[model samples]
Structure formats: structure tokens, C-alpha cells
Target: MGSLSVLLKESWSFVERPDRLAENFYARMFLADPALRDLFPITMDVQRSRLLQAIVHAVQTVDDPEAFGAYLGALGRDHRKFHVLPEQYITVGRCLIAALREACSTQWTIAHEQAWQDAYAAISVKMITAAAADRDNPPYWHAEVVKHERRTPDIAVLTVRPLQPYPYRAGQYVSVECQYHPRLWRVFSIANAPRADGLMQFHVRAVGAGFVSSALVWKAKPGDMLRLGAPIGTMSLDRTSTRDVVCVAGGTGLAPLKSLIEELATFNRTRWVHLFFGVRSRADLYDLGALNQLAGRHSWLSVVPSLSEDPGAPGCEQGTAAEVVARRGPWQEHDFFVSGSPAMVRSTLSTLSVLGIPRQRIRYDTLTSTVTGA
Candidate 1:
């Protein structure tokens, strides 16, 4: 009972394989009530990992009351699309505890079990309260795909106009459910700031076996409908900061950064913006043309393309975006926003830390926490 975060974190290490805990949890849940499985996708891989990441994130943030509360609130509201009633949370909590006990094996003490029980009870209350408080917003918004264009073999840009007004900040991402993959949700960053037309854009890449991404990128058409969960993220701009900005994005990670830049363009006049778009080769530089056009229109914006494999590209930086950022030293006075694959984001953040950027000045979303933004 002393420092619940410490108890949870210490027991968290007892599980050697994180995925095993998730798998066991799901197994126990399904066994308790077979019908509960209907609320999830046929493909459980992404969902499994997402659950694990969410738990780990929750545990880590438990020491910070504000962050932990906000995260639980978001999850509570976001999970509404599943039509989960308050009582179902009890079932989930029980199964989760059982799995945690199994994962911790011999090291799991009664004290650890009691702490987790108390923790989950608090989480349930906070989430339930938050979800109930959100009376005005729909559990999920219905949107129709108005446009779908393949930028490459695996990447597609899709535009969807919500049937009703959808409110969100520029850098926030929404969970999207493809019509073809019912109950399967993936997080995709909105590629543009709020538009007069009220259309939202998502950049998707067909990651291996990702049903939602492949459906959106390869099969979705103009008339197809997609369900969108409420937008959630903390990567948006800080209006109070006067520092110049550095945005680093890799591949489809550019979506949120691009949205931030669009938002920045509306009011920016004094601050300089440097955007580094990273890819493996020239063929992967699908949106360079658009970025270049934006940079041309904004005198304070600069777009740099970084190619890790294409050393022959004449105008591009010849390394990963993180490498290029570190090489262009001392962004000591600027705010940093990084997005990309897990590896790229990790590397870029590590590079920034070595450069002594304060944690508060660096904003990056947890992409791994989502099902898949493939």
C-alpha cells in the first residue's frame, strides 16, 4: 500500500514476456464470457499489443495524478465505441487481475494483488465518471470517404467528411474503424487542420496483416463509411511558446506534423519552422511535393527531406532524420515535435535528450499505445 505506482511497477517486471500477460488476460476474459469476444476483432494481434501498451503506460503514469487521470478519461471515452457498460469493467478488472497474478507467478504477493485491485477500482471509477460526463458527443462519428488516392504501392491518402461536425485540435489523432474490419480500430493522425469543408485526411500505409490499414489503403472507396472515435492526443502546439520549432517525421508519421504546420501557418510570422521528412528512398518520398509547396508559400517554413538509403538523391539529406537533426546541432532553444515508426521516434527523442532539450519542450505521441496506425 506504500506508493501504489512502485508496487505496480515492481510487480510489472515479474512478467518476462509482456505479450503473454495480454494473451492470458484475453483468454481468461473470453472463458468467463464467450460473448465478450464479439466486441473485438477477429485479428487480435494489434489489439493484444495495444492492451499491453495501455497497461504499461497506465502503470508508469500512475504516480502522476493529472496524467493518469487524463489518460484513464481518454480511454474510458474512447472505449465507448465498444458499447461497454459499467458492469463489464468489473469483468475486465477481474480477468486482468487474474492474468497479472499469473504473470507475476511466485513473486506476486497478496499486497501486490491488493494494490492492483485498489488501483483498478480507482481507474474504473475515473473512467466511468469521465465516460458518463461526455453526454453531448457520440460514441463514434460516422464519416463517408469522399476521396482515396494511392500515393505509392502501400500508402494511400484518404479524405473523409464526417456526417456531423467533428471537433478536434490540429495534432490530435482519432481511432478509425474501417467498414470492412468491424470492431477493429486503428489510430491515424488527422493530416490537416480543421478545414472549412470539414474534411479530414489520413495517411495510411498497409503494414503487414493490419486489416484496418489494408482495408483503407487498398479497398476503401469514395462511398465507403468509416467510424471515428473521439480525437485524443497531447501533441498540439503551445501558443505561449515563442521558440522556433523543429518537427521531425518519418513516412506516414508526417500526418500529425503536417496538421500542426498547417495550424502554425495561420498565425506564425516571427518563428521559424524546420520540418524534416525522413524516408528510406526517393520512392518513399511520397509527399515531398506537397511539403515543398507549403514551404514555398510560407517564408518562415523550411522543409528538409532525409533519405536513409538513397545516398544518390541530389537535394536530400543523406541519413535518417534523427541523424540529420543531431548533425544540425543545438536546437537548444526550440520546441521539438517528433513522430514516426517506433524506432525512428525513439532514436530522435534519444538524440534530442543528448542535446539537452527539456522533457516539457519535447512533444511526441505514443504511437505504440494504439492498435495500429499502419
Candidate 2:
């Protein structure tokens, strides 16, 4: 491991309360230059978490140059939507150092401060280069909803067509900024493979504290407009792999997997697919009808909707999706895809590890998340 990565990891103990550190950093940044505050959302809660998570991810992966550089590049490309400027990077670095010093309390050493400064410079360079190199792409795309259907009280299935052609792969996700939530951007996985019409589908369930999700589920109509950031993520199909697939989805996590299945259906001549779709109750099986139709049309595909909270529901499995998948596995050879809330994804990954599945065989996109699961 690089000496700086080790230093950052060791100093991580000082940030036991990352939320507070994030708050401190933002407060300092805005105070230092009030104009910068305009770049963030009205609600700072999710933004705080994302900021801390981004730092933590960088700290954790600093030793792996390839992965670390790619992550920073994509992150830089994504940050273009914020309209961040070159000079602002210098201001951010200063505020970040001030926040780190406070986070480390009196225990902070001169060596620690120097290491953090060096680290910040490296991070800023990678991000700036990536953003600068992406000169051909627009900062964002504007799309207007053409179809909207309420799937449940809190869930909605919506389709929108970009004003211009929007290109994206099935499993990738793009950050979206709706009119209702103006500056707030939340990522959502594209629910279908690319079509000639340039229409994109999103399945949203209004989460308790998720403002963007609530707006999309309850307020968005056919004529509503939204802004979309560039596509990111690598959870797409592996055409070279002939192994059958097992997909485990909890609630709306089914979005990306369904897209992959659609892509697979177009070209796959072999390889059976088993999908376990889990929800709290049958009422939450908002897309069951659509899933069933897909299964009916594709002989190699099977859809199992599991109810974690409803054991009495007929025609469905009764357990958490991970639990049911474990019971049915021996999935040692199949390529796997798991998606859901952080808790759900972690649980499923642990189950897969216990079942002895190889780490390389699994693919997922946790990047597409709203205040709630997106």
C-alpha cells in the first residue's frame, strides 16, 4: 500500500463521526465563498453523506492506481453537472484541510496535515483532467416525460424522451435533476435497453425522506421536464460468458437487472436466467405483471417474486431475497447480479461469499441511489 493511503486509513479513526466532518467541511466551504453554496441542493442531508462517502472511497482505494484513477475520472465527469470551476478546486482543498484538522482534534500531527494536502492535490488533479478531457459531451440533457403510470401509492413507472438523442447502455445509470427538486441530482438506473426513439424508463418509489423520489412519484406528469447527467457504471452484460445467470433484486433494485435481461433476450440463444424479485409484501410487487409477461415470452427466463413480510401470500416465495437465493443456490458457476438498498446488497454479498461464489462473477451498481433506493 502507498504510504499516504496507510496514513489516511490510520487517520480515518479521527473521522468516526463522518457526518459531522462533512457538515464542518461544507460550512467552511460555503462560508469561505458563499457563491459555492448555489451548486448544492436545497437539502444538505444526502449531499453530506455523499461527500463523506466519496472521501472514504478515495481513502480506501488510493493504493490501487487503476481503479482509483478511473473512479476519480468518472466522478470528475459527473461533477460537470455542478458547473464546478478550476479555481474552486483550490478553495475546496483549503476547506477540506481545515475540516480534517478539526476532525483529527488535538491529536493531529504536522505529518498528518502534509499527507492530507498531498492526497488532496492528487485527487484534484485526476478529477480536473477528466472533466477537462470530456469536452464533447454536454453538461446535461433535457428530457420530457411522455408517459407516466402510478404503479402503487408510492411507486410510479415513468418514461421520458430526451429532447436530443441520449445514448446509454442498459445497466448504466445517470444522475437526474427534476424541476421540482431543481439542483438536487439523484441517480436512477435505466430500466430498459436503448431504443431508437431515445425514450428512457425509470421506476421510482417515494421514500420517506427522499425529496427527489417523492417528487417523481407523486408530482411528475407526462409533460414534466427533467435534466440528466452523463451515464456511468459497468454492470452491463458480459457477452463472453456462457454461464447461466441468477439475479436477486429487492424492491426496485429489479430495474438494472431487468434491463440486462432485456439486452440478453435480444441476442441470447442459450443460458437460462433465474430472477428472484423480493418485496415486503405482494402489494409492493409493483412490476410483477411486466416481469411475468417478459418471462412468458422468454422461454429461458424465470421470474420469482418473493414476499419478505408476507408468508401467507400464495404463488410467491416467503423470505428475504438473499435468504431465498441461498436456499436455492449452489450458484457457484452462474454469473450473479445483486442490487438493492445498502443493507440488502451487503446481506446478499455476504450470502454469496458463504456459498463460495467467486467475487469476479458478481456485478452490481450501487451508484444509482436516491435518498431512498432508486
Candidate 3:
């Protein structure tokens, strides 16, 4: 793997359909590594589409071949979420080589094939190293339910205080094991930032099918302990103070973005903040007062509540979050932050894309709410 950039560039140019090449890379990667299959659901065609579009965007933005190295690094970091094993890299590497072979003509000489192999090997090494570091230094997970505040019939804000301090950027989530069924683990993003005392909290909504959510709602109690995985996901704040910041969240997707917006308010950043929250009904919405208080304390922050199912409710605008964004045109000037169900995140991103906001300006995570049933 002498020069991955050169190999990638050559492969990129030789391939007649760059989009197909990008898409095939993922297809082959998954086919060769079935162990990672559960990381994505059967209904992941849209996510597959986005990966190709993201790759195209990355390649087109590169000024020099070497500059694309960051894309590889980000990929390595992201692969950690799937818990990719080091030994399986060889299989993934082989699939990548085969895809490159198919995408490029038989014009690809042995030397070219070897170059592609070397490049994938190098990237695999980087990815493996990152995965190792993540395994070695796992995030603190204390699954102790210190306090439970039932916000509504379906939503409960559990104050989970970990045994070890949960050291994560506000917007990340931790996987909690179900006491009723230890094998089942559920991931919940932190609803609040780590306090000075080191307590971490989660605003969990009880979904009928979710095992962990049901345990929290009906079975789990204070002083009960459970297992939890290290923090993961990337829905953090970007380093931009110039653009207007708009956060769109649906249902429990607001958990992570809540921390991000609060951080922004704490700093009182120059970026004006607008939050568009959408739920099925008024009761489905949580923490409205917290957001309202945040808005009042920070003159720059404004919150809008939207309802998809029951617009006739006490305090909700009519329509889906995507429709609301569409009504508020000229979205080009804002940095878009979105979270919720994978569907919501995807829909919002698609809407923002059509509104002329660049994909790079949007940050989101798709770890949606689900319940485990017995």
C-alpha cells in the first residue's frame, strides 16, 4: 500500500460509473462479511444510496488525492460502530479488490490490481487500529437507574448514574442491557450533559415492542443495575459560528440534539438557533418546557412544535417536520442538524438537499427508539 490516493484516483478515473463503483463497494463489502450484516436492517436501501452520494461528494471536493485520506479516517472511525473485527478485514479487502476489477475494464493490468489490493490493505490496517483502540479504551457504562421521572404515559426520563463516569460528548449514546433479558441491549443517547458530579441521564420513551424500553417502563426500578456498552454515534456540534443553526428532531430523536443545542445556548454562540420538533401528537412531544426555558434564557434560541397525526392538539403546527422546513424556504443559509428515526433523518436530509443546503453542513445519527418484546 504505497500510495492509496494514487490507486483510488486511478480507479476512480478508470471506472465508467463512479456511482456504481461506490455502491458496489458496499454491496461487495457486506456480501463478503456477513457477520456485519445486522448492523444494517433489510430495509436499508436508502442508507446504501446515501453512502454512494457521500462518496461522490467526497471525491469531487478533493483538491488533491492525498486530501481524501480524511475520508478513509472517518470511515475507519465509523466502522467501529459496527464492531468490525480485525481478522475479517482480509475478506473485506478481497471484496473491494474484486469490485474494483469489475468496475474497471479488463484493461486493469496485474500491476493495477495489485495496487488496488495494496491500497485496501493499508486502509484496512488503519481501520483495524482504530477498532482496537476503541475496544481497548471502552466508554464507561453504569446502568444504574438512580431516579425515574415519568414525563408522560409513554415517556420516562430516567436518571442513570454510571459506576464509572460516562465520558462522552453530549450527543453520543450508550447501549443499556435489559435486566429482564440481559442478551438484549438498547441504545439511548444522553438527554443532558454530564453534570459536575458525573451523573448521566437518558430520556427514554417506552415503545411497546422494545425490550429494554419495556423494562424501564414496567419492570426496572431505582437501584436496579444493568449492563451498558460504551458511547457511540456522531451528532455533535460543528465548528461553525457564522451560519444559522437549525435542529429538526422527531420523537425521541431529540435526545442527542438536546445536548447539542444546550451546549450552544451555554456558549451563547453567535449562530441563531431554531428547533423544529415533530411528533405524532402533543403527548408524544417531551421536554417542551425545557426547550421553552432554553429559548427564553437565550434570545437567539426559538422552538417550534409540529404534529403529523394530530395538528388539532393544544400546541402544535400542522404537518411533518419536512413539510415545515419546506414552508420555511431559503434554507441555504443554515447549518442543518437532524435526528430521530432513520426514516426521519433520511427524509429531513433529503428535504434539506433539495433546499440547496450542502450535505456536509448536516450532522445526524439514526439510532432510533425501539422496544424488545418477550
- Provide the overall lDDT of each model, using Cα atoms, as 2-decimal numbers: 0.89, 0.86, 0.69
Top lDDT prediction, candidate number: 1
- Residues 1-374, model 1: lDDT tens digits: 34798889999989898888999999999998787999999889888988887888888778878778877888888888888889889999999999999999999999899889999999999989988988689999999999999999999999999999999999888999887888888998899999988999999888988888999988999999999998877789998899999999998899999999999999999999999999999998888899999999999999999899889798999999988998995899999999888888888889898989898889887753342265
Of the two candidates 1 and 2, the one with more favorable lDDT, higher being better, is 1
Poorest 10 consecutive residues by lDDT, candidate 3: 365-374
Q: Taking the tens digit of each residue's C-alpha lDDT, what string does model 2 give over 208-266?
A: 78888889998999999999987877778889999999998988888888899999999
The CA-based lDDT of model 2 is what? 0.86
Each candidate's number of clashing pairs is 0, 0, 6
Strongest candidate by TM-score:
1
What candidate 1 gets wrong by more than 4 Å, as runs, is: 368-372
Q: Rank the candidates by lDDT, best first.
A: 1, 2, 3
> Which has the better lDDT: candidate 2, or candidate 3?
2
For each candidate in turn, the TM-score is 0.96, 0.94, 0.68
